[model samples]
Target: MDADETGRPARQLVVWRPDQVPAQHDVPGPGDLRDGTTTGRLLIRSLMRAQLGLSLMCLAVALTVTASFPVIAAMVPAVGRITVAGLPLTLVVLGFALYPVLFAVGWFYHRQARQLETRFTELVDPPRPEDPAAGRPGPDV
Candidate 1:
């Protein structure tokens, strides 16, 4: 502490020596997005493309499955007329099979979405080495 011209004690200044400070990489500032760098845009585009692709794949699968019913009915009239548990085969497939197929598609979509989110999180905010449990297995429940 040093005395000022007014005789009041001056605050102490703390300084860090060069060797005491950890080295740091050049991280982008908050203004990087407005600075027209393509990194942010590219990441957004990649994520959008992945989502679109997944949506298209699910759409294609749903279309194929739904269209198959009509195609099968037309190509093989006997299949539609066949009885299953006192109900027409077509009615049975339409009533029972569609729900399971839809449920499966929903489950697959949820899993894929979670995976995509995990990958995105890894890209945006990578795990830190200082974290003790980063890659460690948890105890059994």
Candidate 2:
């Protein structure tokens, strides 16, 4: 229940050092911004590229596993017995289990990335003002 000099939470006291105050850059007021708009197409493109790369890697792994499961099964007898219940262990392990879990993980990652992007866009792009000078008639007549 400790309060600091400013009556803020104790966490605020941690930042009350005697050193020089951090430089305060002038915040750009709405009037100072010219043609204000949040253009994040590059960020969107980067996220898409990242997801594409992930999908490509996942496909590569799938292909490699498909080409090698038979050889592996031939080498190790235990590879044939990896079941979780009364089902064929192979069906339960590979078909019922691994793929769904992999897909869920990929989906979770994509969703989290998208949500983070949305939060970033909200933070970095503050609201724009309705420009008073936008539709004013020119001083010609």
Candidate 3:
């Protein structure tokens, strides 16, 4: 070890154990998520796939509901000619009836999407037990 003008050995500032082995295959933690480790990427990809599937399913339902009206009206010519409350049947169905169906689809999609996100958040950062001392009031003067 190098030393100052004096011939004494320099003091060691740091030390490491050569016998200690690094951790292997430990459970991924929040650090892994922030560090973008392999397991973190897999978890994220799974969540994205779930969200995408939900989106596609919702889109399919909305498209089917919207398209069915035209197909029904075409297949049954009498439906187009009918009137409801001084409005054409098509107008009543498209303007009034369709709104509820679309609204339900949208609501369902929103609820499911939120649930998926909540699940993902839970997976990434599982809830921890509250510290007993945290809630206790500190000693007063």
Instruction: Count the clashes in each prediction.
Output: 0, 1, 0
Error of model 2, residue 116, in angstroms = 3.8
Best by lDDT: 3
Error of 3 at 98 (Å): 1.2
Largest TM-score belongs to which candidate? 3
lDDT of each: 0.67, 0.53, 0.73
Q: Which stretches of candidate 1 lie over 4 Å from their true place?
A: 1-36, 128-141
Q: In candidate 2, what are the lDDT values of residues 1-141, reduced to their tens digit?
A: 467688775643233321233322343222222223233344455557776776676667656655667788889989887656667767865676577656765676666556655554444344333445433333331
Residue-level lDDT tens digits of model 1 in 1-141 = 577788887877667332343323344322323343566556667778998899889878988887788988899888878999898887888878788888788778777876786676566445545566543333322
TM-score of each predicted structure versus truth: 0.64, 0.38, 0.67
* Residue range 8-117, candidate 3, lDDT tens digits: 88867554321242322376545565667787677788889999999999999999988988889899999899999889998888778989988899899988887887
Segments of candidate 2 deviating more than 4 angstroms: 1-45, 49-71, 81-87, 127-141
